[model samples]
Target: MRAHKITFAALAVIAGLSLTACQNDDDAAAKTDPSPVTTASPSSGDSGSDGSDPASPEASSGGKDTSAGTGSDKPGQAAKCRTDGLKITAIDNFIDGDPDGTVAVEMKNTSGRDCVIAGFAGVDLKTNAGTLSAERKGEPGDPYVLKSGKSIAFSVTYPLNETGGSGVRITGLVVTPPNETKSVTLPWPGKPSLPVTDGSGDPVRVGPIGSAGQGG
Candidate 1:
């Protein structure tokens, strides 16, 4: 009976060891191969914002939308308006706010290529003895793109008694465009429309150069 009891205890110990080993095997398998997780993929056709490719007009040209008609010329590529390409002409006009004797002027772009003009045109009322400088008037505004055959306007205003009591007559005016060194002579009206300067060093009151046919 003692030998049988010892054999039964040994059998019980062996069965417990086998059961523990099976549990450890299962834990190891669970760690090595886990259940796969599902994830959504991105759309293969999506390029970027605005639903357009990288080579689109707004993207390729450095963020410029060419369809909006901004301009073809790039910044710093084209030169300023040249004296040779400009044709200055004089027109008589009387504006309420301006002085009594106002001479309207036009700067036509005769150049074959597009150019830029802005601010005021330097004016020197040409006299027989010497040239009298014109006092610039008005605030400087944005530059205008003067394309081929397009033009802009500016004016030179004079005092009511332009003769300065000397009865002097102005033959014409020597106009130098903004950023230009050379000056062009624009013939005055048949009579003395521009007043003779009193050597006050005050400008002849030149206006800003804006769109063509529009008095500036």
Candidate 2:
């Protein structure tokens, strides 16, 4: 009877040990593989307060689409329009003649719109001493139409002798478009001066005169 009681107790201990081992294996498996769960609640207002739809692609990307034109689609902006459509390119040459010297003014139309040059174009010669003398060339007539990307050349003959200088001094050259009082200055290679036969019978090199002045 004593031996049988001992065997019964051993069997009970083995059963308990087996049950505990199975429970431990289940707990480890659950920890290793976790499943994702979805909730009904929305994340934020941008996600849609009513929860009907997702945010637009732009909104989701965090900004508005700017590929399309938004503001200021005019050909030339207001500020650009204020200035004449013409831009001075190169002052080709200055020729010494009866007057001080004639300056060749070259210009380019840089604006998007076509430039119509109809009225008077003026070029001012300034001595190193800051004395300003202006020469007017071309009167109002048929507009000198310059399409976009086109160039035009005009001459402004000034009395270089009047300036009383061996070298022609050109402080500034400006062109005034029709109906517009403002003038745009033509860019020159260097300080305005050209050598040539002085107006006097005696040949005096007036310096480098503009090619336009020489009728080039």
Candidate 3:
């Protein structure tokens, strides 16, 4: 019976040791192979309130736009007008009820294609003594588009020599279009108009080119 008791105690100790070894193995496994951690990824194709996409190709590059044309590739704009194919005329007494002495010069664009004209026409008064270039007056406005067969004109205004003052008598005029080197000559249209002085303050001045009717 004693031997039987001893054998039962030995069996219980062996079972307890087996249970301890199993618990140790489970702890080691938990330390070596842990649970995977979950993280959030950044959102794609997210366009902000400013209508720009942060992840787009344009944003990645630097937001430079090259879709529009450059240099001579301007769209919808005509070339500058040239004096070669133009027909020019000068008329005296073009405008009635004028206090200042005025001469109107008109230009017709005979060029087959459309072109543009801006600023003032170059005007020089021809006198018995010498030629005097008229000064440009007023700020230049936007360019005026002169379609084929269309016309534009400008005026030369000066204080009339009403008092028979000793002034230069203008006999003719030499006119050049803006941005053009060539010029045209026209005889001054009326009885010679005289200027008090062609000097700085009282100089003859040319107006900006505009509709043909304005010149008259």
lDDT of 1 by residue, 105-180 (tens): 7877788765655567888777666666877776865555565676677777766554446545577888898878
* TM-score on alpha carbons, each prediction: 0.56, 0.39, 0.59
Local distance difference test values of all predictions, in order: 0.60, 0.41, 0.64
Off by over 4 Å in 1: 1-76, 95-99, 162-166, 190-203, 211-216
Whichever of 1 and 3 has more TM-score, that candidate is 3
Query: Which is better, 2 or 3, measured by lDDT?
Result: 3
Backbone Cα, N, C clashes tallied per candidate: 4, 18, 0
The true-versus-predicted C-alpha distance at residue 81 of model 1, in Å, is: 0.6
User: In what order do the candidates fall by TM-score, top score first?
Assistant: 3, 1, 2
Cα error of candidate 2 at position 214, Å: 16
- Which lDDT tens digits does candidate 2 get at residues 1-216? 111122566657667567678567667766766655668986554322221121122211122222211112244311112235656554535543344344455555578654333334444444454534343433333223344554555555443343345654445544554345687665544435533334443221221112132111
lDDT of 1: 0.60
Tens-place lDDT digits, model 3, residues 1-216: 111122566657667577678567667776776767779997675323222212222211222112211111134445567888678998874456666677778888788865656678899989877888888888765555555676777778766766676666777889999878999999888547665553544677898876224321
Residue 202 in candidate 3, Cα distance off native in Å: 2.3
